[model samples]
Target: MKNIIINFSVMIALLASCSPATEKKVDKKADSTEVKVNAIPAPSPENNTVLKSYIPVDLSTLVPIDVLNTKSTDVYEKYGIEFSGNCYSCDLASLSITKDTMIWTNVCDENDTFKIDDFSYSTEGSKTIVKTSERTYIITQIDKAPIYELVVEGKKLELNNKRVSRYFTTKKALSLFKEHDCGDFEG
Candidate 1:
């Protein structure tokens, strides 16, 4: 019994030493604060970055007024953002979702406005990812609405996520923005 136990212990020790430690590499770029682990470098989109990039704003007041996950609003009711036009001040996109149909329109008056590509969206947990046939749109929640940070695929457009830069006050945008504004919109 003692010999058998000793042999088993020796075998376990040998096996432990023979196993290789899995190495995990974490690389963080100073520019974009995203930390990727053992990341495979994606072919950089000619006009876009792989991760969501935003201008850092003082959001101290915004958080208190933000409706992160409110009871009064549902996912479908929230409008998704669209950024187009070669200029940073492009017009916003609009979505009208009904029981049977979904409509997305580029509302900018500029002819240079970037258009939302033919894409579909699905929710991965609370985050909704909008993807075109070629690339995925950078979708994130801002003021309770889905904002897409995209690099106009074919154009030299610099489109910024409007939620952090300015307030979206369209009728549909207002419906959801009011929920977090803590203003007179109680419905």
Candidate 2:
């Protein structure tokens, strides 16, 4: 009989020590918000189907930017875009140059136009200078790669342009040149 009582007491104690996973309490005051969570949120769907690559290109695959940017030359290149969560049509960019005229096109739209015909360009060290009637385009390249910067009237233009084509070198510098003015990735 004593053993049964002791066991009963122990059982009661063990039950008391356990805690409920969730508890409910009512707020006496009106307009009170109480939120209690017990489990993690369900997984959401994946949005971006695109993936990115960081591996550098083979040097043997690259051509000089001066050659690609030359007026008599026609250049076309594509860039594997970095998958930065959300991706629009601008995920990939295409650039083409014909007779001192450059056009930037993506999967979504027609193209953006840039005129080198109105401007005379000179290669100085790591920079390309295009002289326009109203603006002087100072294009600085990075690491001999095709990544270029077009600073016109002394302003850094944003060309969400893809990486350089030298890495591929045409697409990048050209895209950078395209975006140097305005318009979003899709724009």
Candidate 3:
């Protein structure tokens, strides 16, 4: 009986020494060897389209303002446009230049003419700038199309030409088909 009690007591003490304590302790400093997660952002719809590079060229390098103003010039033209969404209307807009006049016509046959001398002309790098009392116009010639940047007060708006060459020569040499539905607007 004495031997049995002694062995049992020894076994209990060994187990008690080997077992973990019930108390819990938290460290004040954060662990350095923690697992980190890096999140990647989702791709946007606008990022999927191919982007075109634009390099501005000097205005005078393409055509001198003197020659352009000497004759009636078609500054810009846009036609055969179909609006998106609920707007199912087709519209057109045009800008024409003459010796001492500038004319613009838009939807609903609204037209406006202004005198050339009413605006001051200057060139900044590749842009030909024309400034009025309240508005500023930046014109850049690109290939057949010219881009127009209009600045009023502090707001800026941009517009581009749709058609540069509207005359087509038939293969049969029948006649030169001219695009006149847009009117006598020419550049």
Please write out the lDDT profile of model 1 over residues 109-176, one tens digit for every residue: 42322345355555443343555556543333444443332222433334443222222323433445
Against the correct fold, how does model 1 do in TM-score?
Answer: 0.26
Scored against the true structure, residue 103 in model 1 reaches a CA lDDT of 36
lDDT of each: 0.36, 0.38, 0.33
Which regions of candidate 1 deviate over 4 angstroms?
1-92, 95-104, 108-120, 145-170, 173-187
Question: What's the TM-score of every candidate structure?
Answer: 0.26, 0.32, 0.29
Estimate the lDDT of model 3.
0.33
Candidate 2's residue-wise lDDT over 129-165, tens digit each?
5555665655455534354443457443334543222
Best by lDDT: 2
In candidate 3, what are the lDDT values of residues 21-95, reduced to their tens digit?
Answer: 322112212222122211122233233221111223222122111111224344322211122200222123334
TM-score of 3: 0.29
Looking at candidate 3, the ten consecutive residues that score lowest on lDDT are 59-68
Q: Which ten residues in a row have the lowest lDDT in candidate 1?
A: 56-65
* lDDT (Cα, 0-100) at 35 in candidate 3: 21
